[model samples]
Target: MNEELSARLRTAAEAHQPDRARILARLERGMSGAPDRHRESSGARPWPRVALASLAAAGILAGGGFAVAAIVQSPPARPDNSGTPAAPSAPSAPWTPPHTTPPAPTTGGPSAPDRSSSTSPSPEVSGGTVSARPDSAHVQDGPLWSAGSLDASSNTYWAQSDITLKTTQPLTALTVELRITQTGAVQSTGHWRTLPADDFTVTVQPEGAAVVYRWTLKPGRTVPAGQHVFAGQYNHAAGRREAKHDGYRVDATGPRGALSVWGGFTPAR
Candidate 1:
């Protein structure tokens, strides 16, 4: 009996064929709590129902477990990123500072251009000799100088002052003024200079307590280097009029700067 049962089991297993429609029908009836109509129609025994259920379960596992899961379950949740070891991040590149251009080199100061070799030259006196006047009252200042002499030809009724100026350099501008202290009815007679008459503007006027005679070189005109003379003639009351208090002022301009000289006059005894 055991051998025969084993043989029968072998034959049943061999004859078993997986039918999706039949298995699903059975599954549907079981889910709906309805009797298995096919089993009742065939008058199959209860064990046959058990066998069908078991075979159905086996068919599901063997044939269509993945297919059933694909139909029944929702799409798998997005893969969990937390547990997975993150792909090794590509090695970070070395940091490098931005390239910078340095500021241009600078100099301490701008090189000054070379000016004239010298500002003031050794005092140059062109025709350079100075006149000898033993009897004259003379005063000198650097390159610009002046001298005064009382004219011997003056009579008791008149007196004269002769002024001489010497300059080493050609004078671009010159002004000579003589002030004779008024004594005994002093009055102007005339005035003269060695420079061209047109080169000077002469004026005789009374200033303060003295008679002033001025010679101004005209604009655009120049006095050549050497000695130049200017004279003032005036009449005074009968007696000898002392000229010790007489004075002179000279203002001259040269290439670099101005020259000025002024002093009182001493007539010969």
Candidate 2:
């Protein structure tokens, strides 16, 4: 009978057709059979065997509970977006310092414009110059420069405070000539010309140097004041024609009187 009861309990546990009520019924039958044996043996039946069987059945139920718990706790696997296995934490990129290159040097200075290879003359305007060696020159206490202009407009000029030589030659045939460029450049060659006495003015001041007629710039109907013609050679030039001077001056009463002069005016085109 005990074997038959054990067989029934096993079938209830393993059978797919057995419901919860059937399994409970098999357990009740097995428990009742042991209690009856003890009652027939005057309360002394196989107690140890019954206890072992009960323990075995409890173990099977516990195992089923554990299996259900494992199914609920387990999580489904997911595909990784990155090809490589992701590290526990991505390390921060190495720190990089910014460039430390020095700034370009400044380009500011006080030099004249670059004209080493230039052949053009100086501009005929104020505060300007051409191909002059020194930035400025001095005038002697005697005659600085002389020019002739009859055009009745105003003339402009520049003069420095240095480089004037007292004339050693006597005033035998004192004919002063001045040369100036049409664009107001002071040339080294035939730019100088002698001025006719009528077209020029000579003012000899008592205090300082005397000023001969300076060139004057004017309109079409009028002639610059210093514009004139002289019939003699100037600085060993040919016979006279209409001529102009960069500037001109007469010596003061003193022996070393000189004039600082430069021509810097031009006729309008």
Candidate 3:
């Protein structure tokens, strides 16, 4: 019975409320030929909200794709704050091995001249004479006093006299003096000296008014022998092949008919 009474109460409430038709009628009146308050208040349709949400989602996706593309694809290089781009470095060159040859002996004898390398002495001035003098000489101990023995005393002796002459032909009357000295001997006397070649191998020339004479010392030999004074025509000169005890080499090519070389041995100071 109580259940029945509650049902009746609900029925009564329904009866007092308007029917669906009446509700429809009220809505039509509010909407008929007039602006809708709901539409006016919102200012736009509700569907636009959905469209805006979709557009926003698309924009976000595009921006994310662009960011990913910048990382994967070529990215613009950033410049340094100094406004200059960095340059790539050059690669290093490969190392080469050092050449291997033993260094030449440092303390060996005089190097042999390279014959293959054509090397000539400086062109000697024509008609000029060059000579050499000894810097020092020593008298050997003991006396086997021969003219040659004087040469032994002269071991410390050397002759050097350089003369140059510029003449159309060889100079005539070229006089060379070889100063001989003896020590460790009981007595000092004059003796004869010799030259290597007596065929006027020693040439003379006029280097202006001054006559220049030159003689080269042969290897393993010291003094040149023969005539003391060499005199002859510029083209054809004569020398002494054999010297006399008086120390004079015969020369027939002079105004005196015979020119003599003058020299002697003296006590060394």
Q: What is the C-alpha lDDT of each candidate?
A: 0.71, 0.35, 0.32
Candidate 2 per-residue C-alpha lDDT over 75-184 given as tens digits, one digit per residue, 9 for 90 to 100: 75554887876556678999999989998866776756777753433323223312111122223324323322233322233221111123333222232323232332
2 against 3, candidate with superior TM-score: 3
Identify the superior model by TM-score, candidate 1 or candidate 2: 1
- After superposition on all C-alphas, the RMSD of every candidate to the true structure, in Å, is 21.0, 16.9, 23.1
Highest TM-score, which number?
1
RMSD to the native, candidate 2? 16.9
- Candidate 3's C-alpha runs over 4 A off are 1-48, 71-74, 77-179, 189-269
Q: Is 1 or 2 the stronger prediction by lDDT? A: 1
TM-score of 2: 0.22
Candidate 1 lDDT by residue in tens digits, 84-171: 7555669999999999999877877786666654332222121331212222333665678887778878888998888889988889
Clashes of 3: 28
Deviation of model 3 at 141, angstroms: 34
- Measured by lDDT, the strongest candidate is 1
lDDT of 3 by residue, 75-173 (tens): 667667896867776989999999999888896789887878533232123234221122211111121011111221222223211111111222234
Candidate 1, superposed: residue stretches over 4 Å from native: 1-138
Q: Give the CA lDDT, 0 to 100, for residue 140 in model 1.
A: 61
**Steric clash pairs (candidate 1):** none
